[model samples]
Target: MSPEQRLASLLAMHGENELVEFKEAKNQYAFDKLGKYFSALSNEANLCGQSRAWLVLGVKDDRTVVGTQFRTKTADLMSLKKEIADKVTHRLTFIAIHEVAHPQGRVLLFEIPAAPQGLPIAWDGHYFGRDGESLGALNIEEIERIRLQNRADDWSAVTLPEASLEDLDPEAIEQARKSFARKNPRLIAELEAWDTPTFLNKAKLTINGKITRTAILLLGLPEAAHWLNPSSATISWILKDRDGLERDYQHFSCPLLLSVDEVFHKIRNLKYRYLVEGTLFPEEVEQYDPYIIREALNNAIAHQDYTLGGKISLVEFEDDRLCFSNEGGFIPGSIESVIHADAPETRYRNRFLADAMVNLNMIDTIGSGIRKMFQIQRNRFFPLPEYRLNERRVQVTIIGRVLDQAYARKLAACPELSLDDIMLLDRVQKQQPITDQQARHLKKRGLIEGRKPNYYISAELAEQSGDKAEYIRYRAFDDQHYKQMIIECLEKFKTARRSDIDRLLLDKLPDVLDANQKHHKVKNLMQSLKNQGLIENDGRIWRLSNP
Candidate 1:
């Protein structure tokens, strides 16, 4: 059978189960419900070890093909991709939206890819799982099951009995010793007294003096990689120009303890200078935070799925953004939880490796590192790190440089704003959409102006910050200004068409409004004028009431 026939057959064969959901969206369907089902079906598919899940919109619970008139327009139908991506974890969206024309009626098939093995897909910050034929919070047991997938037989903790301490790099071991000493200042003398094998054991890099995969990753010589055969232990740093052409690239192998430093040194930490409004001097800072860079790199190394045989990547862009990615799903369910709670992760992808890194002072076990990255950027008035977690890997982007000078100045002016509030305002500056809850919070504080999806810094904020121009730009003139414009248009032409009135006022309206909304704004202005006896609209034409 053909692909479409195959899909139809599958839908006919299955009822609402963990991997399939049936909805009779004859005329319209709730978009929010679609997002929830996407989350539920994706998680359910992962739990059942399925490659994909089905969401049939035109099908009823009893498996009847009623057809759907939902989002009939191609553009509107396709826009669901972005709408769903905005709120889903890892930006997960439908893999494909298929329309099947059957002998009985039409059918809409939403093909959703399964969630990553270890990461549960969440819609609007809530994980959904299928409970029989209904949807509910992913059961604690299921959540734990997903988390355990990442904890599977940590390759880094596996012992390589034949490998000896001789396979380790002496320089790497010395560096490890210093890091461990710094981490344990009180035990410095004791740490120094131990030999290589003893120190490795004490540092948890070895299993009772027996070489392990973690030992080879952090302290193994380049040639020792053979001991871990098949599992690759390497980090590749690649630089790309504006055109995406490779400008420079280098790979660092085993002995990651020192190679991490080598990778850091290769990056061009240029000085970024931004003008501080109301001051003659410009504030200068590094493109990227040194601590953030190290933390991200070490986190990648500590959490990397070594058994996957994929190399970690550090990709640098000419636009001053650095991306660090490793082969594994994020151990923490979400980055927001880590940032807001600032609590230690309850589990780790590579527990032994993470413990060793913590002992060496490479990463913080308290889970403050990611939060620190956000705080550092907030203090600098730069964008926070962007995290993209997927089934195959966890990627983070550290944006450097001030994206908007006005935004930075506003931050400086408003010292009382919390980091969370600043983050929302930062999204506003970047033209990214904020959640309704966030919009209401910002609106309640009089910190934002205009309708959502186009909210900008409010005039109140601008006035407080001495940004008179921005205040005027974001806050369009009041009813009087629009009223005056309508009167002027009528005066210029004895009678005006509704289209003419729109032409006079639409462009002058707030940029936040769409074309249809702008048209309504013009009609509302005409009605207000008519109510005041200043103008009258005789169906198609508008004119001064007296005229």
Candidate 2:
């Protein structure tokens, strides 16, 4: 199908929105301007509840089929796509680009994908918004709304009125004290002086010495979980084979502080050996860090969305990845924001309950749980923890070993790379979209190459990538060079027939037209090119506007 036809089909499929536009490209199309458009359209699309927005080339402001001659060479055009993708956060890239041929000429089509949940796509470190037809900076209120929209539940603070001190297991309470003492050594002295009720109260696990849902979750006996009401509290730990098939599963009851140890004991923590260059001996490592496991289990117990009637799940896959999925959306902000700020926000789903867990030292009050997870993984040379926040839930997956040697080496080689940089690169390795700024940053660091069809590699990674020859074959074209070519061609072909124009320009153009559609193709190309100020038409004659 032609680019124009495909765009029409896409528009019909998506329906009308303030975000999508069919522009004639009549004025010079600046890359920076396009970047602003991306931010505006993406944000507008999200606010308007649309999945995507389009910037269709070769159409006039009035939706007229002016036909485009915007001769964006295939490689040069791809650079535009890469430029946008690399700059955005999460490495968000276009879904696809389509070129269409019409009787008047050729058209270029850009399909921009929607931003991920809770994460708005920004251009060059700032977000853009559309106020009616005019694009401007995104307002703070809009940003807050986007952030808040994803959160559905906060399970930590829910009151269990019927739950009392008796609901907690005595064994669990003693275990909690030991764990708390281990985490807060300074508290050990004070902890010994306080009675169980006072300690529990101080820990925020109980209100006025009465049991709370936090107490039940952290130290409640398995049988007492039912007494908490509305939902039963449980944690299921599963051991899976290398293929991700479950081999064994065990369920732990609430008053989870003590039961966490029972779950931890099920996983084997053997010594692992790694080759250290220039050394005769291999480096010995633990299979999984004890602190990480404790943190993961405690985090699950503390942040679970019990209102969903879902139990916190810890799944250990054979592929050496540990996944913990709780029943709630992530708190409204980037994981980086939470870590870097090192302060809990005022708004929390379960403020009171989280306070109790913090006092007990089961969870950090500063909202550094995720940051700590990243630090631990980095220290262990493991892939960073991956946090997936959807509309309904938050899933965190931590890989125990290096999945890509090249990626690991790249990270190892660059000790100066910040945690945020590492997180962005990890997303790239996982084939997730990133912003244009992020793409440029990675390119600058020599960790990745190409523009749109980009790939990450250490020097060793390029060798292991297997398709080295193919990577070299798809070299991106220089935009300035291609633009110059378009100008020169239009100058030389003054008054050239449509057929002649197509013959001169077809090969280098974007892949938006069929081999047989040369007549319609030339018409669209001249139209778009003229609009972009690359060429000017004097009745039947065409020439470069400035040159």
Question: Would you list the C-alpha lDDT of every candidate in the order shown?
Answer: 0.83, 0.67
For every candidate structure, what is the RMSD over all alpha carbons to the true structure, in angstroms?
A: 11.0, 15.1
Considering summed lDDT, which 10 consecutive residues are worst modelled in model 2? Answer: 467-476
Residue runs of model 1 more than 4 Å from their true location after superposition: 1-152, 477-547
lDDT of 2 by residue, 1-547 (tens): 5445666674464333467667677434777777877877877777777777777777765556666655445445645655776676555556556666656656667776555556677898999887866779999998877776657554555557777777778987887787678767987889999998998877777778776667777778777877666775777889999877789999877766667778888777777776543367877887778877878777666566667788888898877778888876664435654554444443555666667666666677665666777887776667888878776677788777766554555555566767867887787667677765456556765666654535444343344444344333333345455455556666665456555566666665433224555345456656777778777767766677776
**Pairing residues by index, what is the TM-score of model 2?**
0.57
The number of residue pairs in model 2 that clash at the backbone is 43
